[model samples]
Target: MSYPHHLGMTVLEAGPERTRVSLTVTPSGLNMHGSAHGGLIFSLADEAFALISNATAQAVAVETHLSFFRAARDGDQLVAVATPERVGRTLATYRVEVRRGAGGEVIALFLGTVSRREKPA
Candidate 1:
C-alpha cells in the first residue's frame, strides 16, 4: 500500500542531508480559530524529517519537537526546509525550519531524531 497521507501534503524535495517541502493553506485546513492547525504544521515538519532522515537509508523517527512562532492564514504558502544536524550509523538528527514563503516570515522551528533500521536479511 502506498503512504498517501504524506503524498497528499505535496512534499517537494527529498535528498541527502536535506529536504524541502511546501504546504498551501486552505479554508478546510484551518482550525476553529481560523488559523492553520498545529497538527498540520507538525505533519509538514514530520514529513520533511522523514524525507531527510531516510535519504541515505531507511530510518524511523524516535523523537520530535516543534515551536510555533507565528500563525499562518488561508492562502499562505508555507515552506519547510530540513537539514541534517547530526548523522551517525545508528542515529540521525535534523532541524526543520518552516516559514511563510510568500512573505518570508518564520512560522515554526522543529527538531527530529531518527534511528536507522537494518535491512532485512
Candidate 2:
C-alpha cells in the first residue's frame, strides 16, 4: 500500500478501490472556532477517495458532496473509510465515512465522483 504524506495529513492504508485513512489534530489543523478545520477533514476524505479511485489507473475528480455532523477538537483522532459506490467505464463514485476513533462516532460523510482516464495506448 502507498502512503501519502501531505501537510496536516497522512494516508494509513491504500488498496484496490478502498482505503482506510486517518489524521491527528494539530495546533495548525484547527479552525477559527478552535476545532479541527473542516477543510482538513475534507482533505482526509478526498485522499481516501483519490486512493480508491486511482488505485488501478488514472482518475480525476469530478464532484464531491460532504456534510459535517460533529466537531472534531484537539486530541481527537479522525479516521475515514472509503468504499466504492459505483464503478463505470468513465466515472466512479465512492462513499466515505469519517468517524471518531475508539468510540466510532460518525462525524461526517462524503460522496465523491471521479472520471477514469483511458489507459495508455
Candidate 3:
C-alpha cells in the first residue's frame, strides 16, 4: 500500500497544479503534548505536494519547509491543499496550507520545491 494509505490519508481532489488531501488524527498520530505530531502534519502536507507536483510530470522533492500555527488533537480532521507558486522546465515551487477542517482554523503552512524529471521517450 502507498505511504499515504498507510497513514489513512485520502485525496479529496487532484489536478496538475492543485490538490487536496485529508486525514483524521488517530491516537497513534499524537505527540506527547496530546496534540498531532509535527511529522504527521508535515506528511499530510508533503502528500498533497507530491500529488500536485507529479500529476503532469515526474518530479522529486528538492526542499520543504513547514510552519506550524496551531495544534490539532486526536480525532481532529485536517485537510491540506496544495497549489503551485511557480513552475519551470527544471524546477517548481508549491504552497500547501493545512487546515483544521473544511474551513477551519489554519494549522500549518508548507512550502516545497521539486526538481522536474524528463519523461522516458
Candidate 4:
C-alpha cells in the first residue's frame, strides 16, 4: 500500500490544478502534547501537494514551508486542499491549506515548490 493509504489518508479529489485529501487523527499520530504531530500534518499537506503537482507533469518537490495556526487532536478529521500558485516551464508552486473537518478552522498552511523532470525519451 502507498504511504498515504497506510496513514489512513483519503484523496477526496484530484485534478491537474487542485487536489484534496483528508485524514482522521489516530492516537498513534499524536504528539507528546496530545495533539496531532506536526509531521503528520505536513504529510497530509504533502500528499495533496504531490497529487496536484504530478497531475500534469513529472515533478518532485524542491522545497516546502508549513505554518501551524491551530492544534488538532485525536478523532479530529483534517482536510488538505492544494492548488497551484504558479506553473512555469521547469518549476511550479503550490499552496496547501489544512483545515479541521471539511470546512472547519484552518490548522496549517503549506507552500511547496516542485521541479519538473524531463520526460523519458
- Please write out the lDDT profile of model 4 over residues 5-94, one tens digit for every residue: 989999999997779999999999999999999999999999999999988789999999999999999999999999999999899999
Between candidates 2 and 4, the one scoring higher on lDDT is: 4
- Per-residue lDDT, model 4, residue 5, is 95
Candidate 3's residue-wise lDDT over 25-93, tens digit each? 999999999999999999999999999999887999999999999999999999999999999999999
Per-model lDDT: 0.84, 0.85, 0.95, 0.95
Give residue 119's error in model 2 in angstroms.
Answer: 3.9
For residue 117, what is the lDDT in candidate 4? 70
* Model 1 clashing residue pairs (backbone): none
How many clashing pairs does model 2 include? Answer: 0
In lDDT terms, how accurate is model 2? Answer: 0.85
Better of 1 and 3 by lDDT: 3
lDDT of 2 by residue, 1-121 (tens): 3333644456777886668888888887899999999988898888888888888768999899999999999988888889899888899899999988833998999999999977565
* TM-score against native, each model: 0.88, 0.88, 0.96, 0.95
lDDT of 1 by residue, 15-85 (tens): 97668888788887789999998988888888888888887778998999999999999888888899999
TM-score of 3: 0.96
